[model samples]
Target chain A: MLAESLALSALLFTIGVVGVLTRRNAIILFMCVELMLNAVNLSFVALSKVHGVGGQVFVIFVMTVAAAEAAVGLAIIIAIFRHRQSVNLEDINLLKG
Target chain B: MTFDLLNPVQLSSALLPDLLLVAGAILLMLMAAWRPDSDARQRTVGFASIGLLVLTMGLVVWMAVSGLTASDKGVIAVDGFRWMVDLVVLLGAIGTIALAIEHNVRDGIVQAESHVLVLFATSGMMILAGARDLMVVFLGIEIMSVAVYVLAGLNRRSARSAEASLKYFLLGAFATGFLLYGIALVYGATGQTQIVEIGNAIRRFDLTNDPMLLVGIGLMLIGMGFKVAAAPFHMWAPDVYDGSPTPISAFMAATVKAAAFATFMRIWYEAFYNMFSGWAPSVWWLAVVTMVVGNVVALSQKNIKRMLAYSSIVHSGYLLVAVTAASALASTAFTFYVVAYTLATFGAFAVVASMQQLGETDARISDYEGLWHVRPWLATAMAVYLLALLGFPVFGGVGFFAKWYLIQAALAAPAGLTILAVILVLTSVISAGYYLQVVRVMFMKPRPEGAPEPLPVGSLTRAVLAVTVVLILGLGLFPSRLVEMTQMNAFPRYPFSPALQMGQPQFRR
Candidate 1:
C-alpha cells in the first residue's frame, strides 16, 4: 500500500514540476507549485502509516504554509497585473540583465 | 541552563527572543495602520522598528551570556552559534531600517507597513537561527520569504519593483516545494523530524547508504542552494536585487542570506556529520562554481546593484567553503565571515542608496565617475567598502580576516579541501576585477561635465556609514577579539546524550 501511494505521489510531483517549467502564465506557475506541495503531502500521509504521526503533523504544517504562500502569491500577481495588464511571464521583462 | 521543549513553560522561555520580536512586530503593525500612509509615519515606524531590533539584540546577548542550552529532544537550539547569528541578523535589520527611513522618502514609498514587514521578516530570521527541527525550518523560511516578497514590491509606483517581487515569489515558492519534499522523504527514511534524532537514527540504523536518505539530502541541498543564491540556482538574484528598492536589496543580501546560511550549516553539521563523505564533494563543487560564476559575470555588469548582487553571490561561494569543511572551526569561520560580509554589504548599499536622485533609479557604475572630486569622504568610504568586499588586506579590515578564516577552515578540514581552497583564492582575485573597477571609477575618472552633485547624505545613512566603516577597519586591525569570540561560539560537537534520547518519542513504534 505504501509503495503504491508513494509511487503515485512521485508521479504527481513530476507532473507539477513539468507544468511549472512549461507554463508561462504567472497564475499557472503558482498553481503548479501548490500541486507540488500537495504531492509531497500525499507522500507524508502515506509514510505516516509506516512511521508515526510525525509525517501526518508535517502535512498540516505544509498545508498552513501553502495557504499563507497562496495569499501572498496572489496579492503579488495582482500588483504586477496592475502595471502590465497581463500575467504572462514573457511580458514581465522589465528587469532583465 | 537547558530547555526541555516538551514542557510548555520551557518552550516559551526557550523562544523568548523570537516571541518578543513577534509581539513587538504585531504592535508596530497596528501603529503602522493607525495613520494613513505618509513619509512621517513611515519614518516613525522605521525608527520604532530599529528600537525593537536593538531590544531583541539585548535579550539575545543576555541569553548567550547566561549560557543556555537545549536538551536533545528540544526543537530549538540555544547555543553560541544561534546567538552570534542572531546578533548579525539584528544588526543588519537595524542598519536596513535606518537606511529605509531616509531612502523611502526619496523613492516615494510612503507605506509605513514596509518597516513593519522588515520586523516580521526579522522575527522569522530569529526563528530560523535557532530552529533545530525540519518543521520549524520550513515555517521560518516561509515567514521570512513572504515578508521579503512584499518588501520587494513596496514601491508600488515602480513596475520594476513589482516584477522583482513576482519573480522572487515564484522562485522562492518553488524552492520551498523542493525543501518540503526533502523533509518529507527524510522523515520517511529516518522517521524523525528532529535533526539530532535523525543523526542518531542514521547512526543506530546504519542508514548512510540508504537510497531514500541520499536522495532526500540531495533535494534539500538543491533547495538550500537556491535560497543562498549559489550559481545555477542564482538566476533570480541579480534581477531581483536590481529591481528591488536599494535598502530592501541590502536587507536581502545581508540578514536574509545570513539566516538561511545559519540554518543550512546547522542542519548539515549537526544531522549529517556522519555522512560527510557523501555530501562534501557536492558542496565543494557548489562552492567552486558559485565563486567563478559570480566573479566572472560581475565583471561584465554595467549596473552597480547587479554587480553587488553578483558579488554577494561570490561571498556565498566562500561561505560554502566553510560548509564543505563541516568542522567546528568552520562554524566559527562562518560566523566571523557573515559579520564582516554583513557590515560591508550594508555599507556599500548605504552608499548606493544615498547616491540616488529623487525618483530616479540610475545605479550604473558610470554614475560614480569622479565621486572623489565632489564628495571625498563618501568616495573614500565607498572605496573602503569595495576593497573590503574584494577582501583586500589592511584597508578592507575585517573583510580580509573573513576570507582568511574561511580559507583556514577549508584547508584544515579532515577532507583537506586543498583544491577548493585554491579555487577560492583564484576566484577572490577574479572578484577584484569588478570591485576595483568601482573603486577606480570613484577615484580616477573625471567628473562628467554638468553632472549634478549627489544629494546630501542623510544623517541616518551617514551614521550607518561611519559605524560600519569604523567597525570594518577596527576589526580589520584587531580581529583577534572577534576570532576569539567566534571560536568560543562554535557549534557544540555531538551534543547527543542517551538520557535525552530516552525522553524523545519513538519514531518506529
Candidate 2:
C-alpha cells in the first residue's frame, strides 16, 4: 500500500512536469505545479502513517509552506496579468530566446 | 517550552547572523511603510539594509573567532565550511546594494521593499548554509525564493519583469514540491530527517541499493538543480535574468547561487556522502551539459542581459563541477570557488547595471562599442571581471585557481573524473566566445554615432568596482592562503569518510 501511494505520487509529479513543458496558458501551468504539491502532500501523509508521527509533522510543515507559496504565486500571477493583459506563456517573451 | 529545570536557548548561536537579518528586514519594512510617499524613506531603507548587512558581517566575524573554542551544536554545524560561504554571500549583498542605489534613486519603486527583500534573502542564504535538518533547509529555500520572486517583479513598469516573477515563482514552487517529496521518501526510509540521523540510519541498515532512496536523492538533486539553474533544469534563467532589474539580477546571480551551493555541499557532504559513487557520475555529466548549453546558447545572444543570463548558467556548471567533487579539499575548494565566482560575477553585473539608462534600456554587445574610450576605468573593471570569468592568466584571476581546484578534486575520485576536467576546459574556452565578444565591442569597435554616453556613474558603484577588482587580483595572485582559509573553515573531512557510511541506511530509505 505504501508503494502504491508513492507510485501514485510519482505519477502525479510526472504529470506536473508534462504540464509545465507543454501548457501555454501561464495560469494553467501554475495550477499544474499546485497539483504537484498536492501529490507531495499525499505521499507525505501516507509515509507518516507508515513511519510514525514524524512524517505527519513534516506534512504539516509542507502544507504551511505550500500555503505561503500559493499566496506569493497568485500575487505574482495577478501582477503579471495586470501588466500584460494576457497569460499566454509564449506571448510574454520580451526577454527573447 | 517543555524544558527541565534549566531552560536552554532555542535559538542556536549559529543563527545569530540570521536573527539580525530578520530583525533588520522587519525594521526596514516598517520604516518603508512609515513614509511611503517620501524619497527619504527609500534612502533610509537602502542605507539601513547596508548597515544591517555590515552588522551581520561583524557578527559572522565574531562567530568565526568564537567557533575556535566552541564544539559543534546538535544538527547545526558551523565549521569552516559555513563561514566561507557566509563571507561570500555577505560580500555579494554589499556589492548588490551599492549597485542598487542608483537604480532605486531613478525609479520610484519602493526602495525599502527591495532592501527588505534582500535582507530576507540574505538571512535565508545564511540559514541555508547552516541548515542541519531538512526542514530548516526547506524553510531557508522558501524565505529566499519568496523575496527573490518579488525582487524579480520590482520593476512594475515592465511586463517582462512581472512575467519573469510569475514564471520564477511557479517553477520554484514546483521544484520545492519535488524537494519536499524527496525529503519525505528519505525520512520514510530512514525514519529520520536530521542529516546525521539519516546517515546513521543508512549505515545501520546497509540500504545502499534501496530503490526508494535512489528516487529520493534523484528528486532532491532535481530540486537543487533548479535553484542553481543547472542545465536541463535551467530553461527559466535567461528570461528571468533579462527581465528582472539589473541590480536584482546581480543579487540573484551572486548571493543566491553562493547560498544554494553552500547548502548543496552540506547536504551532499554530510548527509549523502555514502551515495557519492551513485550521484557524482550523474552530476559529472550534468555539469558538462550545463557548461556546454549555457555557453553555446549565450554565444548567439545579441542582448547583453540575455548573454549574461546564459553566462550565469555556465557558471553554475562550473560550480557543479566543484560540487561533483564535494569530497575534495574538505569542501573548502567549493567555498573558495564560490567566493571567487561571486566577486567576479557580481562585479560584472554591477558594470551591467551602470550601462542601463533610466527604465529598461537594452544593452546589446554593440551598445558597449567604444566603451573603453568613453569610460576607460569602467571598461577596465569589466575586462578584469571577464578575464576572471574566463580564468585568464594576465589578471592572475582566482577563477583559474577555483577551476583548477574543482578539476583536481574531481580527478581525486577513483573514477576518471578527468573527463570532467577536459570538459571544463573545453566549455571554458567555448565561454570565451561570448565573454570576449563584450570586450571586443567595448575596446576595439567604435562607439555608435549619436548614442548618448551613459550617465556619470555613482560614487557607490565606482567604490564597489574598485574593491571587486582588488579582490579578484588578490585572489588570483595569492590563492593559497584563501584556499587554506576555506580548508580551515570546511568540515575536517575530504572525500567521504568511513563514518559517513554509518548514516547511509537512514538516507537510503
Candidate 3:
C-alpha cells in the first residue's frame, strides 16, 4: 500500500514537471511548482509510514516552506506583471537576447 | 522522551551563532526603519553591521575552540569544514557590507534596509554553511535567495535592475523546483535525508546504480549548477551584475557565491560521495564547459561589470574543477580558491564602485580610458584585481597557487584527470585575453574625451579596497597557512570512501 502511494506521488510529480515545461503562463507555471511541492508532501507522508516518524515531520516542514514559497513567488510575479502588464514567459523579454 | 526547549547546553552549542545573526539583523532593521530620512542611517547600519559581524566572528572562534573539545552531532555536523566555510562567509559578508555602506550613501540609497539585506543574507549563508539535512539546506537557500532578489532590484528607477531581479527570481525558482523534486527522489531511494544517514543507506543498500538515485543526484547537480551559474545555467549573471548597484554586484559575486559553493561542497562531498563515480565525469565536463564559456564570452564584453560577471563564471568553473576531483587535496584547493577569488572579485568591484560617478552614466570599458593619468591609486587597484583574476603571479598573488592546487587535484584523479588539467591550463590562458584587456585599456589607451574620471574614494571604500588588496597579496604569498586552516576545518568525506567502493570499484580491471 505504501509503495502504491509513493508511486502515485511520483506520478503527480512528473505531471507537475510536465505542466511547468509545457505551460507558458507565469501563474500556471508557478501553480505547477506548487503542485510539485504537494507531490513531495504526499511522498513524505508515505515514507513516514514506512520509516516510523521522521518523514512526517519533514512533510510538515515542507508544507510550511511551500506556503512561504507561494507567498513570495506570487508577490514577485505580481510585481513583474505590474511593471510589464503581462505574465507570459514569452512576453518577458526585457532580460533576454 | 520529551525534548526541553530551554536547554542551556543545546542553546550554547547548536544555536548561538544563528541567534547572534538573527538578533543583529533585527536590530539593524529596526535602526534603519527608525530614521528613514537621516543621513546617519547608513553610518549606523555600517557600524552596527560590522560590529555584529565581529561578534559573530568571535562566536565562531569560540565554537571552533569548543569543537576541539566537544563531541560531534551527526544531525548538525559542526565539523571542520563548516567552521572554515563559516569564516569565509562571514568575511565575505563583512567586506560586502563595507562596500555597500559606501556605495549606498554615494548613490542616495542610504536606507537602513540595505544594511538589513546584508545581515539577512549573511544569516542565510550561515544557515546554509551548517545545514546537515535537506530541509535545512532548502530553508537556507530561500532565505539567501529572497534577500538577494530585493537587493538586485533595489533601484526601481532603472529598467535594467527590474529586469535583472525578475530574471534571477524566475530562474532561481525553477532551480528550486528541481532541487525539491531531487530531494524527494533521494528520500525514496535512501529513506533518509540526513547527509550521513543518506550515505549510510546508499552503501548498505548498494543502491548507487539505482535509477531513482541517479536521477535524483543529477537533478540536485542541476539545481546547484544554476545557483553557482555553471555553464548552460548562467544566463542571469551578466545582466544581473551589470544592472544591480555595484556594491550589491560585489555582494552577489562574493558572499552569495561563497554560500552556494559551500553548500555545494558539503552536499556533493558528504551526502553524495558514495556515488562519486557516477557524477564526477558529468561535473568534470561541467567544469571544462564553464571555464571555456566564461572566458570566451568575457572577451567580447565592453562593460566592466559584464566582464567581471563572466570572470566570476570562470572562477566558478575553477571551483568546480576542485569539486569533481573530490580528494583531500581538492577540498583544500576549493577553500583556497574560494578565498582568493572572493578577495579579488570584491576588490575588483570595490574599484568599480570607487570609479563610478554618482548617477551620471553607465560605466563602460571606454570610461576607463586614461584612468592611470587621472587616479593612479584606483587604476593600480583595478590592475591588481585584473592580474589576480588572470592568475598572474608578479608581486606574489595567490591566484597562481590557487590554480596550482586545482591542477594538483586534477592530477590526483586516477585517470582522464590529465584532460581536465589540459582544459584548465588552456582556459587559464584563454582567461588572460579578457583580464588583460581591462589593464590595457586603463593604461595603454589614450584618454577618451568625456569619459568619466575616478571620483574621490570615500574612507570606507578605500579601507575595504586596501584590506582586500592586502588579503589577496598576503594569500598569494603564503597560502599554505590558509590552506592548512581549511584542511583542518574541511568536512570529512565519509562512508563511501575505500570501504563502500571495495566491492564495486570504478577502476577495477
What DockQ does each candidate score versus the true complex, computed on alpha carbons? 0.90, 0.69, 0.47
Chain A TM-scores, per candidate, are 0.99, 0.89, 0.95
Tell me model 2's lDDT, rounded to 2 decimals: 0.79
User: Candidate 1: where are CA atoms >4 Å away?
Assistant: B494-509
Looking at model 1 chain B, report the run of 10 residues with the lowest lDDT sum: B500-509
Tens digits of per-residue lDDT, candidate 1, B68-90, equal 88777888988888999999999
Comparing only chain B with the true structure, the TM-scores of all models are 0.97, 0.94, 0.94
DockQ of 1: 0.90
What would the per-residue lDDT of candidate 3 be over residues B112-217, giving only the tens digit for each residue?
7877888888888888988878878888998888788878877655556766777777677778878877887788788888876787688788887999899989
TM-score for each candidate, following the candidate numbering: 0.97, 0.94, 0.93
Which one wins on DockQ? 1
State in Å the error of residue B452, model 1. 1.9
* Residue B81 miss distance in model 3 (angstroms): 1.5
Q: Which residue pairs show backbone clashes in model 1?
A: B397-B476
Instruction: Report, for every candidate in turn, its global Cα lDDT versus the true structure.
Output: 0.91, 0.79, 0.79
Compute fnat per model.
0.88, 0.66, 0.35
lDDT of 3 at B181: 74
